[model samples]
Target: MKRKLIYLFFLTGSFIFLSAQVGINTTNPQGVFNIDGAKDNPTTGVPSAAQQANDVAVTVGGNMGIGTTVPTNKLHVNGTDPLRLQGVGTGNSTTDPLLVIDANGVVKNIGTLGALSIPSPAVFRLETAQNNFLQAQGAGGAQVVPMSMIKNSIPGLTYNAGTSTITFPAGTYQITFVYEAQHNATGCTISSYFVDFPLNATTSRIHSTGAHSEGALSNHGGTITYATTLPANRNWTISLGRGQSGNCSGAGMNLSATSTQILVFRIGD
Candidate 1:
């Protein structure tokens, strides 16, 4: 009786070793290692594709497949919701990229690119309303151009009508200001116009148009554009007035001028 039991055990171990395949809930294994999760695989022959839906397979070549018998890649999953990852923190920034796939199907982050990417710009536009005039400041003097209406503006900018100022965040910005006006007094003329805005606490950039002389009741226009990087968050005083070298003293300009426009665009941080 002992010799018979030893012979039976050896035969069972030889069968398990020689088969070179293992199956759970299945007698006919489709891969080197397979698990029929639903226990509905066919008792004989191969299971249909529908019956193989609830299955996990590991091929002899070390390819793993979830819900598939034949995997094309190292790890292939064939389901509507195939894979999911958990425990990913909630931090997202340009410096720390989330996940981006390259042209060759390789995953990468911003750190791989070795540069900090800039975000899209925030734009704000302010225009004069009907019957609105830009306040006329004499030579060497500047006054904020009051914006009566907001044509189109984005967030992150604060506009105060009473102060006629805009608070800007720390970033590189491109500012554009344009205005058209005519002198109201007879024999009054302006040699030039300029824009004054604080680049920083100690410095202010002036953009002046060249020689826009106009007689009384003569219409004139000026456009100034400048780009600068601010080191800190501060208020920008958008002022349009006559330059110091102009003959605009004792002359009223911007009378009922409604063609003023101010555009502030934040390019990058």
Candidate 2:
């Protein structure tokens, strides 16, 4: 009886050492370490590709694989929705963390969404009103210029002809306004003009216009560009103010051909 017991122990030890592979729920091991998650692996020879769908394997080089017998990377996963991460909070703000893939195909979250560049298509333009005139007002007074046409505009921008106002959406924008004017009266001279919006009272600047020699024939223009961020929707307008003589005539100031051009484009949040 002692000889029989010793022989059986030697045979079991030799089988474990010679095979050099461990398998759970599978007699025919397909890898260095295999787990038949569904107990569907074949009992005879190597399992087929279909049977490997229910198997997890680890290669001799320490590469692990799910739903596949061969693992080419450190952690290879196959099948639909093979990987999922829980407990990650919602990322809805610009300061929220973001997942990015590196050049080596490794996943990382080293930066926030604000650090990335995104495409934005928010732009607006109000232009092209011929025969529009700016009535000359004396110093310290202003006359709102007329913009009758909407040459180009997008959503988030609205124009009201009744109020002579333009409503803009909440965002940071680079705004540019250009105008072409000429003196219509001999005695009147326009020293300055401005593109004004109530929200931009402090930042808006007066553009200088040199004296015009010809009463109605002389041509002059000014352009102003400024950037601002609006926390909410706001209205904007253009006006002629600052350094104007009372002698300026009614039809003395005229904007012809694409005058009173205002272009606004959103740059950021």
Candidate 3:
């Protein structure tokens, strides 16, 4: 009867061990599961990954690893608050105004915190508007006159004596000329003449025809009148002679007389 009791006790102990082994195997089918490294804990109702042990608690002046509570008064290389430097012109001026990434993944210029110290005489040039002059009238007409014709013995007065063919452009111009004659004796007559012609080669002339034999010498002046529009470039000459049939080049005609003749030309729109 004692032998039977021993056998039954041994059988009970063997069954208990086998059941414990079976339960352990059923709980973790994968053999790779580690009891210490498992995220789930069966005791204390706390997850192994979420709860921190008493020994793992962060102490003063201790560096906190990732997933751990940070210590008080500890310097965080990459903390929530930004790390800033206090000074002026303490960086590489060549590569300064640099945009660097902060601890929070924000990009900002390092130079914005302080006043920048730059070189002097940094010029900022600006361009100004220029004034220009344009020629409204082209090269034609009395635009082509001899230099000798625009002069006078007196300073203010200008005289033109020679014959010049004025080829006008395709526009109308008021042509004027002054003729002065100082008659020392009577019967001295002076004539100022002008001719107007069309592009078709038609011609006209303005002159004075009368005899003056009075003792009292008086200055008589009259202007020539004619208005003809030019269809194309044409030529017209002014000839000043002494007497009728007296050509421009003749002796005793005084073509170079001291009396003045001024040719005034004005252009209008």
True-vs-predicted CA distance for residue 85, candidate 3, Å:
49
lDDT of candidate 3 over 5-42, digit per residue (tens): 21223664464222111112123211112122323334
Candidate 2 residue-wise lDDT, 131-200, digit = tens:
4355545455666656654543333566776666767666666777676766656665544655554343
Clashing residue pair totals per candidate (backbone < 3 A): 0, 1, 2
Measured by TM-score, how close is model 1 to the native structure?
0.59
Which is the better candidate, 1 or 2, if ranked by TM-score? 1
- Whichever of 2 and 3 has more TM-score, that candidate is 2
Model 1 lDDT on a 0 to 1 scale = 0.61
* lDDT (10s digit) by residue, model 1, range 175-201: 777776665554445456677665755
TM-score of each: 0.59, 0.52, 0.28
Query: Against the true structure, what is every candidate's RMSD?
Result: 7.6, 9.5, 31.5
Which candidate do you rate higher for TM-score, 1 or 3? 1
| RMSD over all Cα atoms, model 3 | 31.5
Ranking by TM-score: 1, 2, 3
Clashes of 3: 2
Q: Candidate 3: which pairs clash?
A: 141-167, 141-168
